[model samples]
Target: MEGDFIKINEWLKPLSWLYGCIIGFRNFLFDVGVLKSRAFDIPVISVGNITVGGTGKTPHVEYLIRLLKDRFNVAVLSRGYKRRTKGYIVADANTIMTDIGDEPFQMKQKFPKVTVAVDAKRVHGIETLMDSDKKIDVILLDDAFQHRYVKPGINILLVDYHRLIIYDKLLPAGRLREPLSGKNRADIVIITKCPDALRPMEFRVVTKAMDLFPYQDLFFTKLAYDDLKHLYNGSTRELNSIGSDEHVLLLTGIASPRQLREDLKPYVKNLTPLRFPDHHEFNDDDVQLINETFANMPSPKIVITTEKDAVRINDTKGLSKEIKDNIYSLPVKIKFLLEQEEVFNEKIISYVRKNSRNSILAKTKDDDKSKDSHNSGNGSRTISF
Candidate 1:
C-alpha cells in the first residue's frame, strides 16, 4: 500500500545484490542454450521491461495492436497475473475479469477482432492459441522480457523516463527485475512517461547512462490522457468541469501513480489516495474498506480508479450495488511524440518482412534440393549456398 517509490529502503540493497546475481545467471543460461527457448510457428513480438511495474506495457501493447491490426493477424498473450483461473483461457466478449484477468479482458473488450489469451505459463498459452480455430499470423507477448524460454522476433523494452534502469537495482533494492546490463537483450528500447517539455540534454544524459549495445535502438514516448470518464456509468467528463471544492478518493492499484496524483492535485479540493500492488485483485476486504471510506466523506465525493483496476472491481459485490455505480476509471493512452513516427513504423515493418522473406527463400531452396536428390542416381542432396 506504500505509494511512494522513495520508500524502498536500505535493507533492499543486499537483497538486490543477491537478486541481481540470480537474474544475471538465469539470463546467461538462456543465452548459452543451457536452458531452451520455445518458438511457435508464428512470430512473436514481445513488449516488456527490465524494471518492474508501470513502465507502460499495456499502452505499448495496445499501441502495437493499433499499428499492426489491419495487415496482420495478431494475438496478444499475457500471464493473467491475479486471475482465479488455473490454465490457459482465450479472451472473448464474454470472458470475465475473474477468468482471464483485467488487462486481457480490457484488451478483448477494446479490440473485439483481435485474439487475446492468458496463462501463467506463456509458452503453453501460445501453444493453446495455435491449436485454436483462430488464424493467428503473429503473437504479441505482453510483459515477457524476463521470460527467456520464448524467443521473440522483435523485443521492445520500455523504461520509464523518471525511473531509468541506470538508477535502479534489482528486486528488493529498487524497481528493476533485472540488472542494467540486461539491456543487451533489447532490440528496441522505449523510454515511456516522458515530459512534454523534456530537454535534449536530459535525453542525452539518459542515453549515455544506458550505454546501449551497438545493435539496440531506443526511442522516447509519453502518456496522453484523453477526456476523463466517470467510473460509475462510463460517461465522458470534461477534465476542466470538476470543481476545486469536490473532495475525491483516488484508488489505484498500479506500480506508480505519483504522476497521476501530481497532475490532478490542482483541480481537486483534497485527494486521498489508496494504493495497492500492481495488478492486484480486489477481494471482499478491499471492497469493505472502500465502502467505509466513502460513506464518511461529505456530499459530492467521487471514487476514482485507473482503467486497469476498474475492470477488476466490476465483479466485486461487497460494496453496495448502488455504491458500485459511483466508482469511476481514468483512461490513458500512449502518445509517441517523435517527429518520425512513420519512419519508426517502417523500420519495424521492414525488419519483419525481410525476415519472413529469408525464411521463405530458405524453405524454397530446401524443397528444390530435396527434389534434386530424389531424381539423381547418387541420391545425395546438395544445397547451393
Candidate 2:
C-alpha cells in the first residue's frame, strides 16, 4: 500500500499508532480463529471499505443485487448503523430508515423484492436470513470489512479515488478504520469515484499504484449520477433540467460530500452546501434550517440531497410543502470504467453459482480444487501484507 500518499493530521500520529495496534491485535484474534469467524454455506459477498466513511459501498452493493437478483434470491445484511432497534429484524413493507440504516433502507426501497435484514452480529443475521421463508441463494454483507465474525465467500474492498486508503492513516487521525495492511483481506479491489473522463494512462498508474495480488481482480468505477427524484412522490427530474441560471441548495448528511459537490459543479455552478455529519439524524431544528436556507435562496432555486439523506428527510415530519416540492434526491450508481463490468460480473456470478448450496457442483466439488486464497474461483495465490 505504498505510494506518494499525502499525509494529514501529523499531530495525531501517536494516537493513530495506538489505535492501529489495537485494531491489528483484534484482527489477529479473528485471523487465527481465536475470535471465531463464521462462514456460511450460502455464497456471502461483503462490500465494504477500510475507511470509516463512505466509499460508495451502498451503490456497489446495489450493483451486485441488480446483477444477481434475477438469477438468485438475493439477501442483504447490514449492521443498521445508528438504528434505534436492535437484534435481527427483517425488512417488510413497514420497514423504515429507523428500522434499517438509511443505506439499507435505500436498497430496500430501490429493490423491494430483495430480502433485507439488519443486525450488529452479522453471523446471527445471516443465519436468520437463511432460516427465514425466503430462499436466499446468496447474501451480501454491507459495510462489513472490519466485521470478521461473518466470513464472506467474496470480500470486495472499495477505495475512494479522492481519499485513497494509501493516503490515509488510522482512525481519530485519518479516515481509515484499520491498518493499510488490512487490504490483503480483499478478494477484489475497486477504486471508486474516478473521473468520468479518466485516461487509460491514469488507469494504468492507479492499477500499478495499487499493486494488488494477482489473485485479486482490480476494477475502477465512477458515480453515474441519474435523474433527481422527488423526496415524497418519486417524480423524476433530469439534472440538466436545472438551468445554469438556477441555484441549488445542496443538503448532504453523508460521510463525504466533496465528490458530490464536485460532480454537481459543472451543471449547477451556484451551489450552497449545507453539510452534516455522516448518518446524522434529522430533527425539527435541522428541518427548520433546511427550510430557511433553501427559502433564503433566490427564485429558480431548489434543494437537492443524496438518496440516503433523502430517506431520512422523507421520514422527518414538519417539512413545509415548499421544501417538499423542491427537495429532490439525486440517485447515483456505480458504472465500471474501462468496460470491466463484464469481467467483474462474471467473477461475482461464477462464485455464487458454483458455491451456492443448491448447485450440484457445490456438493460434489472438492474444496481443495477451489482457486485462490479465497477459494472463490479457479486460481489461488498468497501475498504478504
Candidate 3:
C-alpha cells in the first residue's frame, strides 16, 4: 500500500513541478520588490509552516503567547481559514468559532485578555490592529508564512519531525507547499513533535541534514499534553483518573494525531481512534457516528479530543447529553527540547523589545512614534520604531 501510494504521487510530479514554478515566480516578484511587502512599526512575529496540514502550529503559537503576554501587549492576526464571514474582524465577547476560525477563537477563549483578529489580507490586518487605541506592543501573524504581503520582523517556521522537509517532495506529490529551498526564508526553524528520548547522535544527524543557512537558528520541541478538561464546564481532571480497565475513544479532527495517540495509550485500557479530516466540522452524521462508536465500547468509556477540536465541538448543536458529559479536551503545548527554551524565549523578547514603538530605540530617536526608513524605488520599508 505504501509503495502504491508513492507510485501514485510520483506520477503526479509533473503537476507538482508546474505548481512549484508558479509559486517560485510569485516569490520572485516579492523578492524583486515588484510586489510590495509592507513592514509594521510595531514588532510582527509570524509562525507558519511550508508543509500542509498540522505541524502543531497552534500549540507553538500558544507557546509564544504564554512567553510574551505577561510583559507585552500581544495581539494575534490570522486569515481565519474557511470562516463564514468576509473581511477583517476582531474577536470579542460575542465572537463564535465560525466568526474567527477555530484556532483564533480557541486562543481568544484560552486567553480572554489577548487580542485576536482575522483578515485574508494580512497587511490590512496589521494596519488595523496598529490603529487600535489599546496600544498593541506586538502582533503575531498566525499561518502567514505564505502570505508575504507583510514582512515580519521574526519569521518562525515549523516542521513536523515525523515529516522532514529534506525527504519530502512538493505539493500534489508530497506535503510541501513549496520546494525545500523555501525553508531558507525562515529566520528560525523548529522541529515540532520530536521524540523526548531522541539521542544526541540523532540530533546531530538531523541538524546536518537540514543544511540551514549560517544566520538561521534551529530548535527542537516536543508536544506536552496536559491533563483532561471538561469540554462543556471547563473543569479539569487528571488523566490518571481513568482506571486501567476503562476505555478511551480518541477522537481527532487535526491532520496528525499519531503522537497524541501514542501518549494516550498507556493511560487507558484500550484506545480507539475515530479520526476525521483536519478542521472537520461535525454534522448530524458525524454526531450519530460518534454516539454509535462510543455505544459499542465497553463500560466506563469516555471520549477525548484535542483543544482545537473541542472549540468546534463546543458550539455544535444537538449533541446527546450523555456524550457531552463524557467528552473532554486534552490540552497540548510545545516545550523546547534540550533546555533551549530560555534561549528561544530571549531571542523573541529581544526582537520585540528592540522594535516596539515604546522601546529604547523609539525613546532614543525622540520621535512621536517611529522613524520608518522607506525604500524609494521598491515601495517597501524597514521599521525601526
Which one is best on TM-score? 3
Over the stretch 289-356, how does candidate 1's per-residue lDDT look in tens digits?
A: 88888887776777778888887777666876546656677778887765646766886666555444
lDDT of 3 at 146: 82
* Model 1, C-alpha of 163: deviation from truth (Å): 1.5
lDDT of each: 0.79, 0.87, 0.89
Q: Per-residue lDDT for 272-348 in model 3, tens only?
A: 99999999999999999988898889978889999999988987887778779899999999888989999999999
lDDT for model 1 comes to 0.79
Once fitted onto the true fold, the runs of candidate 1 whose alpha carbons sit more than 4 angstroms away are 1-12, 266-269, 320-325, 352-385
How well is each residue in 1-385 modelled by candidate 2, as lDDT tens digits? 2232334466678899999999999999988878988887889999998987778999999999999999999999999998889899989898878887888888898999999899998988888888875467899999998888888889999999989888777888888899998999999999999988888898888888887888888999999889998887879989988898899999999998888988997889789999999989888898889888888888888889999998888778887788888889999998998889999999999998877877734444443344334666545754321
- Prediction-by-prediction clash tally: 3, 2, 0
Give all TM-scores, in the order shown: 0.85, 0.90, 0.93
Model 1 error, position 214 (Å): 2.8
RMSD of 2: 7.5
What is the Cα-based lDDT of residue 64 in candidate 2?
Answer: 96
Residue 92 shift from truth in candidate 1, angstroms: 2.2
